[model samples]
Target: MKKILLLFILISSVSFGQKKLDKLLNKFNKNNVPYISVDSLASTKAILLDAREEKEFKVSHLEDAILVGFDHFEIAQTIAKLPTDKNAKIVVYCSLGIRSEIVADKLIKEGYTNVFNLYGGIFEWKNKDHQVIDTLGSNTEKVHTFNKDWSKWLKKGKKIY
Candidate 1:
């Protein structure tokens, strides 16, 4: 119960923007890497990496999330763009977390000591009521689903295919 209360406080403190996050975390935290809950990550300081394609990122992405294109993902090339310290906190996410998991694994293999994969990716980020922005760098509800089949997971906002 103590853990629950502490979580509540953290949630309240980072309650920035319109993220709903009402969906049980258990439902979406089903990932390979030790998952980072959206609320938990939101309240912490870390490098948020977007592991989607360039086109997908243009649709919308988490505030301050650095784009690292997945389809053409290259780990060595990404290193230069990464924080100079390999031990720095890093959280990666893709449209649905699959790609991010791969990216996170690569980061770990490349000597990164603290790498975490965002639980559900941009879909969850938008669904939870967190904010995202467009290619123009303007705040928008639009999110790219990668396809019609994937769009179903997005429970909120304008779905940009």
Candidate 2:
């Protein structure tokens, strides 16, 4: 009985935290780009774009994720690396999905038909036990939280500045 109660509490806490994050994201995102959950993205073959800075990306990122960067995003350079097919599925992610929306919107403006912003970005991905890789291409538990204020959202993984 105690074990079941503990499990219930743990699950409830995680769900509540997720709700808080969802509310926060809703307030920041313009909803111009649709969101893809971590689970959904894990099974998809879409091109993953990390919209965080290069420093943040070095700590850890989704496997095969291309860095387009948020602060220094260059549309021309980004486009050059994408598939010629305008309909190719693409997903963009940032620390907590805010910056990704901006990048994803740029992609949409450039006429990419199937671009999506990762629902909760890399933070949520690690929280969900999804794999992230370092610059060496080795699996890593560390995730760049962007900063201290945003670190609360990441429930799993080693937090890196």
Candidate 3:
């Protein structure tokens, strides 16, 4: 009985401690940061970034989103291609919400004033029935489901090929 109780407490603490990402997401949502749907952002002056790898992004991505993987060693070099306005609204997203938050934090640290993490990442955006365009400007009309491939190794977004 003691062992069972200890295991439960351990699990709870780990989950509770890991809520950092969730907290950041909640704060962003509560603050009412401007969220640009892929379509809306495509129409607006805002910058949409896919914090995923080049190969994965090549598979499919919002037409206007710049591909910049968070784990890449030289992220700042990649960031240089973006708009120079530090206050310009930038939306960062990946397969799931984890890496996006990290990237958003880094952007803020790098002097970006208005950085936002897409709460649900691309999955949530697609799940909301939003359209994800392909590289060639054709409406692919399908979610970039990360599915089990991501679930296995990435342990984040789902895989949908």
lDDT measured at residue 15 in model 2 versus the true structure, 0 to 100: 88
Q: Could you tell which candidate, 2 or 3, scores higher by TM-score? A: 2
Best candidate according to TM-score: 2
Model 1 off-target regions past 4 Å? Answer: 1-32
- Model 2, span 1-161: residue lDDT tens: 99999999999997898899889988998899999999999887999999999999999999999999999999999999999999999999999999999999999999999999998999989989999999999999999899999998898999997
Candidate 3 residue runs with Cα over 4 Å from true position: 1-45, 142-144, 147-161
Residue 70 in candidate 2, Cα distance off native in Å: 0.6
Q: In terms of lDDT, which candidate is stronger, 2 or 3? A: 2
Q: What lDDT does candidate 2 reach at residue 39?
A: 91
Residue pairs whose backbone atoms clash in candidate 1: 18-129, 19-128, 19-129, 19-130, 20-128, 20-129
Give the clash count for each candidate: 6, 0, 5
Model 1 alpha-carbon miss at residue 146, Å:
0.7
Using all chains and alpha carbons, the TM-scores for the candidates as numbered come to 0.79, 0.94, 0.63
| Positional deviation of residue 148's Cα in model 3 after best superposition, in angstroms | 0.7
RMSD of 1: 7.1
Scanning candidate 3 in windows of ten residues, the lowest lDDT window is 150-159
Q: Give the clashing residue pairs of candidate 2, or none.
A: none
- RMSD for each of the candidates: 7.1, 1.3, 9.6
